[model samples]
Target: MEMNGSNSNLQSDNKQEAVKNPGDETSGSTAQDESWMKLVNLQLLSNELECLICSSLIFDPLTLPCGHSFCRICLTRAFDFALKCPTCRAAVYMDPLSHPTSVALKALTQQLFPE
Candidate 1:
């Protein structure tokens, strides 16, 4: 299948947007607004890290061929019912081991929620 460069570009844009210059001056309201935005972004990111099947933060993320990711255990359990993707109902031919863990996603989740 053709690669989608747009996803990479969007990820880079999000990385840029997440960074800020602490030295930059801002009014009280502006600072508060920035804080609120940061909180909203954090929540959105947390939601993205959550596994649909388990309804918890993904421990070992595994991205299916359909481009949907889920916790490894959750996906494995799902496979017992049907060899189909939980999100899109796409047919899954290979075993769960064939799908590699998303290292970057796992590290990001660990870093963000160290507790």
Candidate 2:
């Protein structure tokens, strides 16, 4: 059975070669998709978190009592004309001029869109 022995040895060598050079193997695409999805998710977050008035990535983000958010400077300038939530148009004349900064969202923006 010399031929059979030679065939087995050839098969073993092929298996060893495949194991040594695994980078040529085709892996599942989930890893690639995951990276792509991460980029898309970051883009979506950047879009959603942008200031509605300035249409830019939010800086010094402040949240109104009505849950609308804007940059602190934008809100102040808008209030000079009319005191209302820029997005929702909820009257905020009675509320304090100084709104609380959205700590979490601001931190996230800083992380995603760093200088």
Candidate 3:
């Protein structure tokens, strides 16, 4: 009798392939898990961006006219004699700050920089 191909070798190859790429079910579960984690991270960021001072989501957040906003009062305290936005190094007057905050941006930030 002569063996044209080694049965053990074929079996080994199959096993290796399977290990490299698991079945559809396993791959699907991994994908689902990744999606779930992404969503959770988004939620966390949303919660965080909610202004700690206002206890509400930041809206038209002033760039501190000092680049930092704090529910109005926070910005006022951060203000220096020159009246410059602390964060952006921009000049600001007594004028109120205003800028739009986006839910999408918050989510993206969470996704890109997951803690």
Candidate 4:
């Protein structure tokens, strides 16, 4: 009888271990996958929000006539050198410092990256 009880206990322990181990591994894998996806998405967003000249998050974004957007400070500095679109090389006659900020884009960027 004692032999049978010991065998049953061992079998139950093995069954619990089997179930617990797989669950642990699966949950760990799922967590890792979620974190990886979040990091990839953040990198993509960062790339989109990055200033072409400074390669940093665009602050005080300015939209040009050619529909390209860049940070006002970066564009102002570039215009100081030569008043032309950095992305397209189109002639920019207007003063970059007097250009208005792209309101929708600025709001979106601020909401997404407040820091």
Q: Whose lDDT is greatest here? A: 4
Candidate 2, after superposition: displacement of residue 78 in Å?
0.7
lDDT of 4 by residue, 2-102 (tens): 99999999888876776678666633447777799899998899899888999989999999999889999999989988889999999988887777889
For model 1, the stretches where C-alpha displacement exceeds 4 angstroms are 1-29
lDDT of 3 by residue, 2-86 (tens): 3536777767787677667776553334777779989998778777655554666554344343334444545555554446665
Write out the backbone clash pairs for model 1. none
TM-score of each: 0.70, 0.67, 0.37, 0.68
- Candidate order (TM-score): 1, 4, 2, 3
Against the unseen true structure, what C-alpha lDDT does each candidate score?
0.84, 0.81, 0.56, 0.87
What is the per-residue lDDT of model 2 for residues 1-115, given as tens digits with 9 covering 90 to 100? 9999999998888778766765654322356766998999988998899899899998898888888788888888888878888788889854335556789989989988887
- Answer with 1 or 4, whichever has the higher lDDT: 4
* Native-to-model Cα distance after best TM-score fit, residue 61 in candidate 3, in Å: 3.5
- Give the candidate order by descending lDDT: 4, 1, 2, 3
lDDT of 1 by residue, 1-115 (tens): 1246887887777555545444444222366777998999989999999999999998889988888899998999999999999999999886776678999999999998886
Pairwise TM-score winner, candidates 2 and 3: 2
Name every residue pair that clashes in candidate 4: none
